[model samples]
Target: MSDLPLRSQLAVALGRTASRMSRLAGRGDGSVIGGKIGLKLDPELLTRLSADRKLVLVSATNGKTTTTRLIASAMSGLGEVATNAFGANMPTGHVSALAAAPGARYGVLECDEKYVPLVLRETGANVVLLMNLSRDQMDRAGEIWQLAGKWRKALEGVDTHVVANCDDPLVTWGASTAKRVTWVAVGQHWREDSWCCPECGGPLDREASHWACRQCPFARPKPDWILHGDRVTAPGGRTYDLDLQLPGRANRSNGAMSLAVVSLFGIAPEQALPLLGRVASVAGRYTTVQHEGRDIRLLLAKNPAGWLEAFDVLEPAPGPVALSINAQGPDGRDTSWLWDVDYRVLKGRPVWATGERRLDLAARLEAAEVDFRVVDDIEQAVMAVPPGKLDVIANYTAFQTIRTRYGRAL
Candidate 1:
């Protein structure tokens, strides 16, 4: 394990060892792997990642991985950029990503929200992009709004040039009022989160699809950074046009956000747009695979918000599904929080639960009055998992497990 070729490999080995250690010790995580390793590694990284190369840290409750990869891709169109496509977002994860890069010009790392302050301070990023805030992993992560507030205050004190999402009222208020702020927003989506005022907590009255609060009478003013279009036209919290072939409004936002970061580095949109199409898929994010004559869409679903949006995007209908559940690693070991998600969203879909934590998830389905078959192992479960048209979503830890299992089936 110590002789691993890459940091991703090291992280994977450590993660597996930690999971087993946790099981033996009856602890959720093995002996503080992240913090312990982080402390031991913090000093060495500064000399390792020198001032010659730029480091841009991307942090968010969600969309960090997507934004990080897109930003890296957009940056590479201009020049050399090294990044960890793997989903390691914590301080340890960020360290591993940077260490793994042999001689990359820029370091683009998707950082975990809780570890953002420390990594940001250490990395001394030239640009820091803050995506929207939403409820995720209540068991491990506390209040969403509270964490957002704390992040806003901490980032404001930092000297890094801040780029933030403005569609979210919470982020908009924080960024719009901050120093060196370039706020970005999108046009109205079919499902929007800002209709209600996060301030006085009033319903927003749509003026022209742009939106302003009716109860509080606070209308949304455009951000300082108008990269391509207005908020609604921008779509998924980024400046989006029609040319990008990425699926879903979320990917569009990711493209726009990526372009914005690259634009800051003087990369022209026209030059970068064509190059973006050439970048390959960053695995485990809507990564598709065919298994045993069945089409499987593997999505990494984490919190309630992410799952709900994925449920909307998947629109599973009457198709078969394999919902893999695992509480190990970054997947949030506590299964009690499953109740918060709307599993009923799986209604009318042929969904079956799998993975080590399948029984735990099955219990939630029973409680929710949603019937689902409990197939303990993902491999065995895939036997019955629809072979033609199917949707499979595995959150955090389960995704890696399922990919390896179902990949064998394919």
Candidate 2:
């Protein structure tokens, strides 16, 4: 039982009641509102809820939600593990999850990068997962290096054992000063943010697998866990061939990092492999939805790095694809990063663009000489495609909107 003050316990009860009310009213997912109310009544809701639990905190610029789902699913074999499976990574989300699952002795949280330190401090998490960091939500996130600096300071003197990606310079620098670290050589495909040293603004030298600053001491740490092709080599020479429903090299990388964490908990990679592989979609990502006679698959990519991975999976599809772009609050106000993606790859493919900023995407596709048409309604644009398995991609808010509409139909 929690040793929290009586006042704090009352606050938690009040917050859970609010969550129920929100859900009943059809306002939205009750997680956010519940968290807000809990924290309002008792600012220490995170600390109280996280008490006496084996906390595993996961944070990164991309893939945190999917990685968290993979980790949580793998942990399910252990027992009832509390997690915010809906992709809410803030303090309130953590509070809501813990409050809902009071019986859970184990907690796995996907934390936002900006709030990682606060969550770490509050929960006193034993293990932290560090994935590669890249440019995301440029207006709110500012520069990527600044976020890395925040991570670096947060890890300093912290007692948690860090599982970090050694292949990415930003991640390396952030996890460098941690009390203890387990480096994993999960490859990084995005290098634009790490072109120069985060420690010292010097030119970085790159080799076949790792990178290092030419003039400074900051260099990539050799990974204790390494991914070679489809196989992952863990400590003590144990190897497991990654078999995941989630496609692409990125998910494989995420699985490798998760395996490294699982090993630390006395669970073998072989035993956890099947559990992680069963996670086909985190929330609505990569979920198949039948809408208006067209079988549409939902794909979400928030940034350039994410877009690169999504394109790799979408390229082989035999039908025309639809893309929705929006600059809403959840999707970030800035959409200039659209220019950085290699849209030329879609040169010969027929593209249907629709969203608040479809014109922006149209401009990019037109400049690349890609054959495309813009439709105002997303559902109609998707349905207008030749009847078959339709491929659809959208930014965060735009994706959520379509997922809500057709997800109900399913």
Candidate 3:
């Protein structure tokens, strides 16, 4: 850091001081505030702090934080790593993460879908991981394909290597302009947002294993990494089983993507699988807490796509499930996406609705013909269920509220 400009050095110092003050004040993890201060002092602090390190940026509508964590953990065998473990995907968070670990040889930063272009331009990243794109926070992010267009323009002449999901047309089209790319066939379960061609604005020909546009040459690329049930086959036809602590097919896809990214760093899948499996929980997602003799698990689902994936990981029927929703700023000031989720799958299971927008959730559940009880308090909702395991699925702010109540703070 001594090699950096004097203004950038002072910015880093002040940012660290502000972060310490924020932690002392018990506000939160000072990632955002610290970076905000740093950027205010020196606008190019992200570029300066990111100098002389191999950087990899992970961006997606979902699973960015978990995939960043997995790639960072697997890269630990090399040396020190800098990363934002929390779900802060903006430039401020990236500045804070890089400033915090000045000596780290490698950096794995999670980037928000909208800020992908800005971060890529600033960081000049060595590798960029493009995961699935879907409709999330519609009030803020207008459409998925529009964002993909921005991504396509950003990668036009960049020298970075891209690792993209081939199953998602939006993601495939986003990485289409990159000079070098490694496609991975990570499954896409939510297909509502990507029903058409991103290139020619025509309908896509869909099949079980492949998809192509009816009006353009755009189609699914031949994948360099393919994900099967619990296994992943690499380029040379070598297969490895994914024994991960994370649950659901969604996480399996995340694992396969992480493996492909780490392989770019010359880390073999054999050496990375165990490290990926050791990650039991990310932030507060998939964490189980024992409260009053009842085991309660936390799952963060912020959109229709996220909710669809959450349902796949819930315990078997008859176990109580709690659904929580909020229209806070962090969660996007809209609840209309609730209707897109098919809650009918929970028809036979005991269901409870809680949070600031309990009525909205209750209404949606009713329309789905799934009987549910509305409980204003999360603890009360959990206690109302029989003393056993209860699963809690919530949006961004609601999940944070429960996590903080359970003594887990991000």
Candidate 4:
């Protein structure tokens, strides 16, 4: 195996082998094994295989995958491009993305907050974009600040240009640690969590529709070369509307932030705004499917914040909802955080609980006095779902499996 060329060796060792193992052990767990296998391969071979040679590493609590795909799409004109487009941004997925690409110029890697520091250290990317930092997957990802510390340690002394979200104190503070960086902020109409600084526990003040913190002294002014979108007009002849097809004001901010970073990368807002409006789908993110004439919206809900955001995007749970939760060890291994979600909103509506943790989901639903059925098999739950406007909300692994099943049905 060692005698084979580096690319061939990677195929034999990582992609084919790790994919088999990933499927065998289960889907999402394979990223760690993939990462370990990749780290064992030739490191210097990457630089040797480089051409056009610009890597953009984007990481955030949310919208990382979407932005990664968007950035990859915009940057494709530069040269060969590769990314963890399917939400594989960890070590092995990182190597697999590059290895899978074979030859590429610009690498638009959509990395996770937890994996950013390590990926940055290994990839030595030219441009790094940090979207925002928030509490996500507490059972697995822990706190945002803790992950920020890991990012800081992992990013020590790596020479690169960092474009950060100045609106988020945690993200801005993280970017502040970078020696050379530019900050981007947006004026959001929605009033969400903009009070306390992730650091110093200080009160953050809002000047424009956007905000900053003077207490921690953490809130730094936007750098000279920054992009600010004080106003946003949604796609369509709706003309002067403040809504988005993807749902919620938060996504607008995420989209706007991605626009800001794209602008920083030599793409103008005027040129990219039209492209941004063209975002059709991100696998299972608020994506609706037609099953037996019923419109099913599949949303990825893992943590409290994400679940809240998903719920916000939805307008009053239409009918019975199938809340699928994956409790497999690889999918965080712990399902304790289900309590954080306000299942009461789903009360009076019929519910079908499926996935590896159906019992847990049922328990949450039951506590809210919501009517539900606990099905051991997700496919059965999906199949048993009668027609007439049913909505399907799934998490990561569950979403993939559901897609594989229904994608074939289609």
Candidate 5:
């Protein structure tokens, strides 16, 4: 602490104190609040704390938190890794994470899509991971293509190495301007957001896993890394099995991206794969908690793209699915995104809708011809099902509420 500037040192100390107080008061982790107070005290604290540390900034619409957790876990093999393990992905969270772990030699930060450019510029991160781009909290984030334009401008002529997903045309367009980039072919299933080219506003032609602009020269970049099913094929044709504890192909894609990022820091995939597998749950995304003698798994799906991915990880039929949604400040004050999700997939499954915005979800499910019962309370929704394993898929605040009520396991 003494090695830092006097103001930064003071900022870190005060930030830690504030975080402790917040925890003592049972108000929350204080990650954002602490960083906010610290930044107020020392405006340059993020730069000072990020200096001399090998930092990796991860940004995406859906997998930012999971990918950040995977990278941080793998980086921990080298030494202490400072990361925002929670879903605090703004500048305040970045400042709080750096301040909390001053002695850590490495930092892996989950950055919000909107704050990626600012965090990238401030941290001067060694590697910036850009995953898929989709409509998430459209009220606050505007449009996905506009966000991609901002990323393209910010990464233009940058020295940092970029690890990007090539399957999503939007991500390809965003990271194409970077000087050094390792493209990973992590498949994108959500196509509603990117039907046209971000460069020329032309219709994009999709063929299997490849996409090309019908009007412009922009196209999918040849990937240096490819994720197929549970296996990740890296450069030199070396294939590694991604035996991750985290479910679904989305997490495997996240693992592939993490492997690519850590490899730049001299961490071999063989040594890092196990570390990635150790992350069973990230910020309660895939946590299973016992409530009312019934085991319920919690999965967070905040937007259309996220819900699409979450559907892939859901348990098989007969295992009732409880869905919860909220339009809280953290979750964006908009419930119209519900219509974007195709709920017909849950037609045959036993489903229950419960949350602050359950009516909206119920209406969407009805429109899709999916039968669901609206239960006001989550526990009641779970009780409506048979005693066994139940999967609870929820948005931001609803997920937190259920996790808290059932006792946060992660």
Candidate 6:
């Protein structure tokens, strides 16, 4: 930045001051406003900051934060790496992150799907990780396929190498035109959104593990990397067992993709596995907090797919689980996605629904024939757990609320 003009440097200085003021004011994480001010002053702030860094961009509907953390952890072996660990994934967040870690040699950024093109173009990232695409925040994000189409258009003729999930047809179509791609079969369970070919608008012929378009040339490419359960097989038949603290098959897939992305940086899975395992919690997800004198493990469930994964993690635990839902800005205004989830799995278990949308969740539980009680207060919900450890799952806002109530920094 010393080579930059005086006005650009002043913009950066002002942005940093704004970031400090935002933290002092307790407004939020301060990433958005800081980057906003910087970009407002110098519109090309991201491009300027990321000029000489080796960048790896991670984008997905789910597991992006975890995957970004995993990649950032592994990249530490290479050099100083910059990332937005707080889940601010838009342009503002990217600008703020680059400014915060100005000396970092490498940047592993978790990019929002809509802003991936701009970030990629500006940063000139060498590797891009394309994770699964799903229906998330529909009112704000629009359709999943529409975003994928933008990705395809944005990536055209770019020289960056892509590591994409071959199991997802949407991802496959998005990365099809990349100059260089390393396909990874990371195992996707959500196929509801990718039932047809993005190329020809035809039905895809599906199998147990792979799919192909019946009417078009586009299909699941041959994967150079594969994940079998918790073990990931590299290109050379070398396998690394991912014994992650983060539970569930979804995390296993995230680990696989993270391994694939880092491998492009010449960091093998054997060296990256231990680093990835150390991530116990990401922004309060999959963590236990002592709040109101009960041991409450926090799980975040925002949509049907996320709820399904959260239920799988909660299934093996004890009784009287707590669930909180909210229809806030980040969680999306639509709660209709609840009906799409298979809540019958909790039929015999006792559940306590709590949050801004607690009644909506209670009504959904009733319709699903599940036994549940409604308690809107977190303290009461924690006390409602019978003698054992309390397990809690909440949507976006509710999870952050509980985390803040417990005095954890956002």
| TM-score of each candidate structure, all chains considered together | 0.77, 0.97, 0.99, 0.78, 0.98, 0.96
Clashing pairs for predicted structure model 1, backbone only:
89-112, 186-231, 186-232, 187-231, 187-232, 187-233, 188-232, 294-387, 294-388
Worst 10 residues of 6 by lDDT: 311-320
In order, candidate lDDTs are 0.64, 0.87, 0.93, 0.65, 0.90, 0.86
Q: Is candidate 2 or candidate 5 better by lDDT?
A: 5
Q: Which stretches of candidate 4 lie over 4 Å from their true place?
A: 1-39, 43-52, 153-158, 186-198, 201-215, 223-250, 315-317, 369-371, 379-386, 408-410
Best-to-worst order by lDDT is 3, 5, 2, 6, 4, 1
Off by over 4 Å in 1: 1-44, 47-50, 174-177, 187-219, 224-240, 363-371, 408-410
Report the lDDT tens digits of candidate 6 across residue range 1-410.
68666877887888889989999998877899999999999998888988888988999988888899989998899878989988889888988888888788899899998898888888899899998898889998999889999899888899999999999999989988888889999887777788888898999998889788899888788899999988989998888788998899899999899889888788987889999999888888887777556677888888777877788788463356888898999999998888888788877677888899888888889999988888868778787766566778888899998888875632
List, residue by residue over 1-410, the lDDT tens digit for candidate 5.
Answer: 56898888888888989998998998889998899999999988898889999999999998999999999999887889999998789999999998888899899999999998898888899899999999888889998889999999999998899999999999999999999999999898899988988889999999999999999899998999999989999899999999999999889889999999999999999999999989999888898888677888899999998999899988876568999999998899989999999888897889999999999899999999988899989978888877789999999999888888887776
CA deviation > 4 Å runs, candidate 5 = none
TM-score of 4: 0.78
Model 5: colliding residue pairs: none
Per-residue lDDT for 1-410 in model 4, tens only? 34447664764366557866786875653544554565566554333333345788889776787778667766655566877777777766676666556667668888878877766766688878887766556677887778777766665576888877666666766777676676655432323444677668778887654556666556655443333333443223122222335566556666665655565568755666556556656755766777666567777766665676676665465576777888654467677777777877777666788887788888888887878888887655656767666666777777677766665221
lDDT of 4: 0.65
What would the per-residue lDDT of candidate 2 be over residues 1-410, giving only the tens digit for each residue? Answer: 35778878887888889989998897767888899988998998899888889989999988998899999888888899999888889999999999888889888899998888889989999999999899899898788888888889989998899999999999999999998999999888888888898888999999999788999898988789999878999977878899999888889999999998877888888888999889988888888887667888888898999988888778473467888999998889988999988887776667899999999999998987888899998877876777677778899989888998888321
What digit string (tens of lDDT, one per residue) describes model 3 on residues 103-216?
998999999999999999999999999999999998898888889999999999999999999999999999999999999998889999888898888999988869999999
Per residue, candidate 1 scores C-alpha lDDT tens digits across 226-345 of 434312232234433436544556666666667667777888666667666554456556767777887777777777657765675684477777788778757776777677777886
Please report, as a residue range, the 10-residue window in candidate 3 with the lowest summed lDDT. 401-410
Candidate 4 RMSD to the correct structure: 5.1
Best by lDDT: 3
Q: Which regions of candidate 6 deviate over 4 angstroms?
A: 315-318
Question: Alpha-carbon error at 226 in model 1, in Å?
Answer: 7.3
Which lDDT value does model 2 have at 400? Answer: 85
Instruction: Return the lDDT, model 2, position 199.
Output: 85
